[model samples]
Target chain A: MKAYAFLKNTPKTTTPRGKTMMLDKGLGLNETEDLLATAGDYLDYAKFGWGTAATMDRELIEKKTAMYREAGVIPYPGGTLLEVALLNGQFSEFLKETQALGFGGVEVSDGSTNISASNRKQVIQQAKDAGLFVISEVGKKDPKLDHKLSIHERLMQIQTDLRNGANYVIIEAREAGKNIGIYDADGNIIENELQELAKGGTDRLIFEAPLKSQQVALIRQFGVGINLGNIASNEVTALETLRRGLRGDTVGQL
Target chain B: MKAYAFLKNTPKTTTPRGKTMMLDKGLGLNETEDLLATAGDYLDYAKFGWGTAATMDRELIEKKTAMYREAGVIPYPGGTLLEVALLNGQFSEFLKETQALGFGGVEVSDGSTNISASNRKQVIQQAKDAGLFVISEVGKKDPKLDHKLSIHERLMQIQTDLRNGANYVIIEAREAGKNIGIYDADGNIIENELQELAKGGTDRLIFEAPLKSQQVALIRQFGVGINLGNIASNEVTALETLRRGLRGDTVGQL
Candidate 1:
């Protein structure tokens, strides 16, 4: 049972959503266990944030992945790791090593590197064939490069990724979540951009809303069922409160 | 030993000349372990942030406090808890319970509730008499009320609290660190106001800087020796990096 059982207010989901993806950036094994113990029920996916998994001991990574899986949360190496593997032309070795480390999913992203449309589709298909939940991200790591991606291009990419067998297409905002994709410089939503993106429906799309304001806005705009990614581990309870209209900002407004 | 020990940096005071207090708001045991393992050497005090200690099990609080104390970090309940105790006229019980719970220190403040100057000093003295380190806080919790505190009033409070045998006086910014005390709406330091407050000298004061930008700016303005409080558990390592000029933002500049 949840510690705050009496405080639970059921969230209104527009669809059957299965997960909350937490971005874990450099959390030690002990910290990971605490996170799992506290908010594990609320989480479905744990993404070891960009290149961080590579920096930790392989044994540590295996241990952490096992803990998450044991708690029923699918563990995955971030897309940045995949980009690095592809850069070295070692995608097969990357997939094998990820499996060896007990990761259950693969994130296919071109945020930091260029991958042609055909190659992107192939990568998604390969991950799916390898029995991995393929999550593809759309947007550039560089703000200037991301800005050059027109709404038309983003829409096409999302559609392409979904068609290529991606379980979820994440609109990239990076960790900072500002001046990228649908968010503006202050991490506020650009209404027109969000509108265009949601036209395809948000069922298979996860918007990376890292800031509280952004989470509030997204929850308000799309209701509680809207999938959000890149949520910090500590903010899990606060985000759930926002979804359930428990926080002051979303109290009666939701 | 610390990573990158070869780097020449400003030597952190051997005795921690001024206290560095960290806010611990609902950190699980594993998270606490990670925090202590990483930056425990740099920290002098750990605060269980605002009514959070009351929410957790007494045993849990004891365990956490013990961990901190073992690491040479004085652990205490936040001032809001003391304010709660004062509101209920259980000041004596508060001190007794805090000691029993393994807390090595107590914070005295009227942040969430109003306390007369005599009462505030009495609380500080009582905590001291109980063999606990006493840290008093100045400023209201509400931003509007906090903004009404003039530099002269703030300076006077700090002076008075110091005179009353308070170990250190903290300038309140709450957890958000925006539109309170010396920070503006965007969490930026208000230069003129900060300059006026610096007349108190950075020695006996701790600024609750919860934001990275605030940490960076404060470190730059007051040097790395400036006492900062309310640092997030995960950011403990990041803060040490900033202080040592290891991070990109402060590397060459500091």
Candidate 2:
């Protein structure tokens, strides 16, 4: 039973929608348990944020993945780790290691480094072949590189990634969620850009709306079923309130 | 046993100065473990933020307090809970419950309520009588009410609280750290206001710096050992990095 059961309201969309992807940036075993305990029901994917998974002990990573899995949340390494592995010509090793670490999913992206289209597709397909739910990210870690990729390019990549066997494609906003991809420098959404990119059916896309403003805007624009990513662990419960229209911003609107 | 042991340099003005009172806003056991594991050495106090302590299970609170105690960190409930108890006229019961909950400290504040100076002193004395580390907070929860408190009034309260056996005095910057007390609407510190209020020895004053920019500014102005409060649980490691000049912003400047 929820603590605030009386405040619970039926969500707008009933279909399996609006998956939340939490950004785990170097959380220890205890923190992971806390996260899973509090907001695990609302979370779908837990990404050990950019290159942090590689920095921690393999045993600790496995423990976290197990906890997340037990909570019914798919755990995956950040896309930057995949980029690093690919850059080092260790994509196969990366896949094997991720599996061994008890991760149920893999995030393939060219956010931090460049990867050819053929290789990107292969990575997505290969992860799927390994029985892992594949999530590919679009947008660059560098704002300069990200801004250069037009909305059409973003949509095309999303379409291609989904076509190539990615279960879901994440719109990369990095951890900061500012001045990259759909969000502006102040972390506000650029409506026209978002509309263009989101044309690739929103069902297959998880927008990385890390900031409160971004989350609010995305929830407001797309309603409760807008999948959000890169949410800080602490903000999980607060985000759920927004999604469920429990918060002041979405209370009446949703 | 730090990651970059070779790069470690002795910080300037290191005399075991100033307390670091972190805000533990509803952290679960797992999250608390991660926080202590990563940044336990730097933390002196851990405050369960707002009325979050009252909202959590007693066992969980005890367990969390134990974890902080083991890490040599003093665990306390937030002033909001104190305010709630005071409002209900259960001040004595509140102190008893806090002590029974394994908390080492109590924050006496009229943040959300108006308490007379005599009653405020009694609250401070009562906590002190209970053998608890008494830390009184000076400011209002409402931004408008908080703004009305002149720097002179704030300074007077700090002195009074200290004279009445309050161990430390915390300046208010609610969880958001914006448009309250010393901070502007954008969360930036108003320099002239800060200068006036900080005439009280910075050692006994805990500035609630929830944002990185605020933390950075406070650390820069007051040096590394300034007592900072309301730091987010996850940002504990990041704040320590800033204090130690490990992060890019403060790296050579500090």
Candidate 3:
């Protein structure tokens, strides 16, 4: 039970209504242990954010993945890692090594690199065959390239990924959550674009809401059941409070 | 030893030249434990940001304070917390509670409230008398109020705080570090104002550099020995990387 359980004006008292995917950019083992002790129960998946996994020692990454697994949270490297691996034509080695390191999931994204539709499907299937949960991402890292992808195209990719045995599809907003995907330059959601994106049900869709405003906005739009991704590890409890209406933002509103 | 010690080509290999004061904006005990374990050696102080310390259970705050103390990091509430305590005429009680909780330091400031200069001096003296390291901050939380204060006024305040027994003075940028204090709207440093502020010397001043660019710029200007405050806990290692030239921004430049 929470310390101030009696004073908590929470809507979702026992369980969170939506899934929260936390981003672990480069957390150390002890730091990950602390995160698990504090906010582990509230998190569903942990993504070692973009290319950062490659920067740490392989043993360190292995320890972190084990910690996350023990906490019952799926751990996966950022899609950029797979993109880099694919770039080097070492996709098989990358998949084997990631599993060896104890990761439970794999993210296939073309955020920084280009991949043909067939190869994307093949990679998703390959990851599933390698005994990992597959999450495919939609959108590019570069704003210019992202803007060129129409709402219909993004929607199609989401549908295709879901059909290709991906457990979930992520709408990529990168870490900044601005000027890419469904958000504007000021980090505000593009209403019509989001409406189109939501055409494919929000169940398998995880909107990368790194910013608090984005989290609040998405929660308000889709109710408390909306899946939010790219959440900073430190903000997990704060975000959970927002979802349960224990925080000021959604207190009386929810 | 650093995990990727082999790949790290860092300058200032032996020691970090400056002090780093991290902002703990409502971290629980477990989170504090993780923070200390991950980046304790790199940290000089841990600040419970704003009025967050007053919001948590007294026992929880005590535990966090003890944790920080054990790690050799001085723990103090944010200046606004003192401002709030002073507002309610509970300054003495606040100081006693903070001491009993095992906080090694106290931050005296009028970031959110107005305190007469004489009273400010008295409070600094009062805190020092209680055997707490006093670090006073100079900057209004309100951007407009902060902008109205001239560079000369800020310098005078810093000198006053130092003379009143403050161990060090902080140039307030708040958490945002933009459009207030010595930073421009785009978070760029106002070089002339910063140079003027440094007239009193940089050794006794801590710049609230929450932004990476601000950290890099300050390090470039003052070398690696410039004191920085309001560093996010997770970014402690990342900031250390920047300080030692392990990060791209300061790698070759430092």
TM-score of each: 0.65, 0.63, 0.62
Residue pairs clashing, model 3: none
C-alpha RMSD of each candidate structure in angstroms: 7.1, 7.5, 7.6
What tens digits encode model 3's per-residue C-alpha lDDT throughout A115-220?
9999999999999998899999999877898999999899899889889999999999877799999999999999999999998689999999999999999988
lDDT of 2 at A41: 74
What is the lDDT for B230 in model 1? 88
Candidate 3 residue runs with Cα over 4 Å from true position: A1-22, A26-45, A50-63, A70-172, A180-184, A188-254, B10-17, B51-58, B81-97, B113-126, B176-179, B184-192, B199-201, B211-225, B232-254
Maximum-TM-score candidate = 1
Stretch of 10 with least lDDT, candidate 3 chain B = B1-10
lDDT tens string, model 2, A126-219?
9999999999999998999999999888888988998899999899898888899988898888999988877756988999988988998888
Could you tally the backbone clashes for each prediction?
0, 4, 0
DockQ of 2: 0.12
lDDT of 3 by residue, B81-179 (tens): 888889999999989988987888889988888999999999999999999999999999899999999998998999888988999999999888999
Tens digits of lDDT, candidate 2, B1-254: 76766665647335444578887756777667778888898889998765555544566777888899999999998776676567656777778788888999999888767789999999999899889999999988768889999999999999999999999999999778999999999999999999998775687899999999999999889888788988887788888878778788788767
Give the range where candidate 1 chain A is weakest over 10 consecutive residues by summed lDDT: A1-10
Ranking by lDDT: 3, 2, 1
- Which residue pairs show backbone clashes in model 2? A30-B30, A30-B31, A31-B30, A31-B31
Model 2 gets an lDDT of 0.83
Query: TM for chain B in all models?
Result: 0.95, 0.96, 0.95
Question: What is the descending TM-score order?
Answer: 1, 2, 3
The complex in candidate 3 yields a DockQ of 0.08
Q: Model 1 captures what fraction of native contacts?
A: 0.12
